[model samples]
Target: MVSVPTHLVSADTEWSPLRSVIVGHAADSCFPTAPPHMIKATMPEEHFASFRPKNRFPASLLDRADAEVRQFVQILRDHGVLVYRPKAIDWFAEGGYTAAMPRDGLITVGNTVIEACFAWECRHREIELGFSEILADLEKDPVVRVVRAPKVERPDALYEGIRGFGQKDAVNGEVNGTHTVHSHEWAINNARPAFDAADFLRFGKTIVGQLSNVTNQKGVDYLRSAVPEGYSVELLDVTDEHAMHIDATILPLRQRLLIYNPERVSKRALQKLDLFKDWELHAYPYQPAPRENPPRYMTSGWLLMNVFSLDEKKVVVEAGDVEFAEYIRKLGMEPIPCPFQHVNSIGGSFHCTTVDLVRQGT
Candidate 1:
């Protein structure tokens, strides 16, 4: 059902410096894409009254899924892991993403956090990009801080995802995930998009279930149900074209490693295509067709690879050969590949598989 690398058997995960990670609901519909079947589970009689996740998830696979992820987060924390929570951008609803306490791994340029809009999801609460300040407070170190684009504009119809025409459709039509670019396009530091969902899911975002009307608001509800109370939600406002997909250009990785469709971003984004700051990036080339069973990039996101592990030089990526290898190399970092053979078609990779709760150290 999935393709894994032959050499991964000997690959060591021990040396990994996994720190913060991003988690998502397993077997659930991808963000912005609703799983229609989930609607059949029956909402709690009181859900309409209180609209509470606990009531909705009184006991079900969805509840179980949330527990597994939370437990996973707790287990890692117990092991001295400094988990930094990534806000779940409920693209399908109003509160776009739920903000996690800021820690390491967040990025900023010009005194403005690249994740500023992420805080916009909540009405009363606000989540700012505190990663850079946090990192600065400790080491007083400075990495590249430059605002390349102001905001990403949705891709022209020419580049939006076109059916059947192959990448030519994707390219001329937003060539990669650029289809989701917004009215503006900008990147502080023009950091590589690899660490973002778009890069990881260049091939396609694996959407399970159906569009069950589980909108961003519901997504926010789901987060409040799981994370500790001190937290709030922040969701990105998105429209058609890009829909609710996570924009990869802004993901903040403590490590500079990146994954993305070089063609989908702006020339500024493209300018940094080969630049991997101290990080050994991995590139997973995507195949435009099912006709090409052995797609170039199999480790697409929205699946098992949606996590951010704070490991050492030995980062575990659930990708095959080709772009995966190139991706790590692009980051100026080394790769500790996973067994995923054809992850792209299925949609995901190591990052997609695990989620991040960032901290200074793990």
Candidate 2:
């Protein structure tokens, strides 16, 4: 099979026609045993203990998630897309979790593959899963510049503040379930620069990044400094306390069309940014309980916003989201419904499971 050339790996915008992508593996997926407080901050209060260190994801759930991923891959193949899977690792023996979400580790910008600096200890080795695919692209094209995240030592004092509560109270509440200590060494702290791929919303020359538990100030600074000249990164100041990734909050399906979780964004912040005002924004009306016993531990029902656009006129929505599909159709886009409720257990949907390597337009 001819791999996508490294030079062609540039994705200028999300609405462009997609030709190549890296789909995640659901097999052997384990919940982070030592997930950072950043990860915990995104979960619901009642489900906070589920991701504690030493706790592994259920095997039965992993199998179901894998089954859904297989179907998603087939759908992409049917659409004439070239899909690459991660190099399956022995997540159990290796310690930590699996490389099921490539979107969290790799960020491809204008033919360059940036290895994201992870805030969670378990995610440090995730880039290795796609090494073979990246190597092939590099061999085919010299324009590819692989930017590696700089390493940083842990700070003597790590600080994190939760809404309405001091860092001490917040940390104690999460760890002891008592809402006590207000400040302390953060369970997970990015001393230097670190960011997940999902932190960005790329739109050609303009990109929007949100400050969240997973993405720190340094991470945002690093991205702003790294992009090519003429391109700019904007910060989306969403006030939601649990906001972890930008995909579930703001998603641009095609040119002049976007979808967002109304609850996840601050209206005042949205108004100040002229970049998003012109676009026709539609609020996804998601009423949880999309399925009985859906995985609420890892992600919220807003995962419905995590759809992937195949082109300007076609998008891959979760099969369970019939209402969302209809909404997409109303917006004049074709919705390719594929079963993904099972895969949501692993913490993302189509956009979260795959990372676009190449898009048709700039």
Candidate 3:
């Protein structure tokens, strides 16, 4: 039996004994709408045409995704973890993205839940529409603090001043004004604080993050100021030009062992942070094959690295990734397989679908 956690929002590290979490619903999920440059920068090239307004995901995919999520919830509950569900919202009606990827909007660090300042306008209301109630409930504990995203008066300012803010060919390889260049120039300008919560990961008192198509320098600064005292946000120099979220780039299986995608981030980048000095970091050696059936609309095949840890010894992985399961097993982790390809069809896998609320030993 699992013991109840004293606080509702208390998690710092990714690999801990998860006591409570929020598993998202997949109903009414739609293809998230964004400006041409933004969409071109982050989404799959073949699926760009489907990202217009009011484009709902195929009904068949949503149904299967919901089933997978429900089964995932059951598996978590069977392990004695408390699960929270968000109120379903019609993404097509709200002109927003699906709530199935809550890790993109909310990050629980220490005892605080900080909402992301979303760069895409379609995702601005995601937390308010689907997760307000859960935040309210979490706030019932005196120790839990919910740091809401500040309203953006001029959302378009984020993309303004760029050479091609709305053009299809704007983000094609040239460095735009003032935008930091990594593998490629970032899509969004540093006009306002903008970040998806998935861009940052908590490691005890230090949060490691990156600037991507959706995350800017200002966003990193805002996160640094919003985190609790003694907590600091550090940026890693990742090499993925198509980067949006950082979950697939790195995976921390437990306290000392971490698995990373060598294709996106280099070993030197990981070494830049003192936090990993004593930790073991291994680059994923195998390249994951692309799924043709479900069709990854938003992410790459590297989503295989997006596994979630239930504790230091056990992790939740996609059922079909037997090769990955076996690989991690050799590293001393038991992979609990669950079917999530349909969930992958929309966006993200286990780590992207849920937010760890109460992990013991934080």
Tens-digit lDDT string for candidate 3 (35-79): 677776788878877877899999999999999999999989889
* Highest-lDDT candidate: 3
Question: Best-fitting candidate, measured by TM-score?
Answer: 3
Q: Rate the local accuracy (lDDT) of all candidates.
A: 0.29, 0.71, 0.89
Residue-level lDDT tens digits of model 2 in 136-226: 6554766666677665465322233332223333443444222221223223344567678798978778888877666777788888777
Better of 1 and 3 by TM-score: 3
Clashes of each: 117, 9, 0
Question: Deviation in angstroms for 127 in model 3?
Answer: 0.3
Where does the lowest 10-residue lDDT sum fall in candidate 3?
A: 172-181
The regions of model 1 sitting more than 4 angstroms off are 1-61, 83-115, 118-257, 262-269, 272-282, 286-305, 314-362
Runs of candidate 3 with Cα error greater than 4 angstroms are 166-184
Write the candidate numbers in order of decreasing TM-score. Answer: 3, 2, 1
Sort by lDDT, top down from the best = 3, 2, 1
Residue 309 in candidate 2 has what lDDT?
90
